[model samples]
Target: MGLLRLGAAGVVLGLASMPTFGQRASAVQLPTYSYFTVGTSVSVPDRGGAWLDGVDRAGSGVQSFGSARLLGGTRAFGTGRSAAGVGITATIHDFEALEAGLVDRRVRSTNAAPAGNDAWTARLDEARVSRAGRGVPSVAAINAELGLAEQAADQEAAGWLQRGRQAEEAGKPNVAKIYYGMAARRATGSQRREILARIAGLQPSPEAGQDAKTSETRR
Candidate 1:
């Protein structure tokens, strides 16, 4: 991946370098307000094709705030319909990093539940061992990982839209509205319109209906 620059709006903008098999790139800084995030994107061209894109973010303290697979693009290298294929994957994690403190040396657990304390400690030990295999963890390093995770998650518009649909089907309109709003923020064209319409449907008021009509007119 190329060097990432921060825009005036604090968005991380960068181009990913073409990737080869068994290749790894360093993490790039991502924009965040309250915490830190970092990300890496790779495209590996192999038998058919494979790609991995991920971002990580730190929580308020020692937990994972969230982690997501933001984007994946692949192309097949064969002939006819069977010759080529393309696929994409996107994911998001909210309230992530519950075990982040266990992995990072800088974070010390304080308010954990008593019942799971022992299990948590064991997990922390495992994390410590894993970290040792890589290297000592530092605040800067952890923040970079989180930034990457956040960046990856931020790119997952479809994931958010799906979540909205799931919440709506579950009869949780309020929750669905939140997810739809997130999806609409990143969606475009018909997809965005569909998400916005779902959101409007959740609001039960004549004014909301009028507002929707006005929005449609403007669009």
Candidate 2:
């Protein structure tokens, strides 16, 4: 699946905590509530192509980023097993190719700039979801009950860079400088270099006179 998605809350407590294979003393396997998982397999065709493939049991959430080679449209098949304990499972997918397309409506509406009013927000939301939903599994069940969503670690870093751009465009050099510094840490090599260049341009250089004075003082 491409960038498998996650849905809301699900518990994945360890089976060890429960009665073992031999002890027949009355013990219950804690009822696990399932959440929605978004996945992509080659099997989904046409409209279903936008859907994901996977089963999420109660109280369990999934979050991962990874790539899946489509076997055939609407015919690909794969398997995943639930762990015996309480935790989330994730698989990494290549997000670079998909970045231009996916956008969570909820995220955009909740966090986009004001200039991108509700109308603009809706447009951007649609664009992102359309891209992200591709090959994503259905997590409605998980989200409706639990409330988990698949998230990316680098997502926050991208946000910071965006904010920095906004600050820079608004003529807030000091604020932009701080943001650029942050972006340099989170960004890739090329992006980091660009951010550093921007920051260097905005900063004032030390005066030669001050340098000489400092040297004399030290002597």
If scored against the real structure, what TM-score would every candidate get?
Answer: 0.24, 0.23
Q: Alpha-carbon error at 73 in model 1, in Å?
A: 95
Model 1 scores what on Cα lDDT?
A: 0.50
- Alpha carbon lDDT at 113, candidate 2: 46
For model 1, residues 12-117, the per-residue Cα lDDT tens digits are 3222312322234333444433322223332211112222223233333222211223233332222211122223344444343435545563433433323455
lDDT on C-alpha atoms for all candidate structures:
0.50, 0.47
Per-residue CA lDDT of model 2 for 56-114, tens digit only, reads: 33233333222223211122233344632122233334354357345565567655544
Model 2 lDDT, residue 190, Cα = 66
Poorest 10 consecutive residues by lDDT, candidate 2: 42-51
Best by lDDT: 1
Q: Candidate 2: misplaced stretches above 4 Å?
A: 1-154, 203-219
TM-score of candidate 1 versus the correct structure, residues matched by position: 0.24
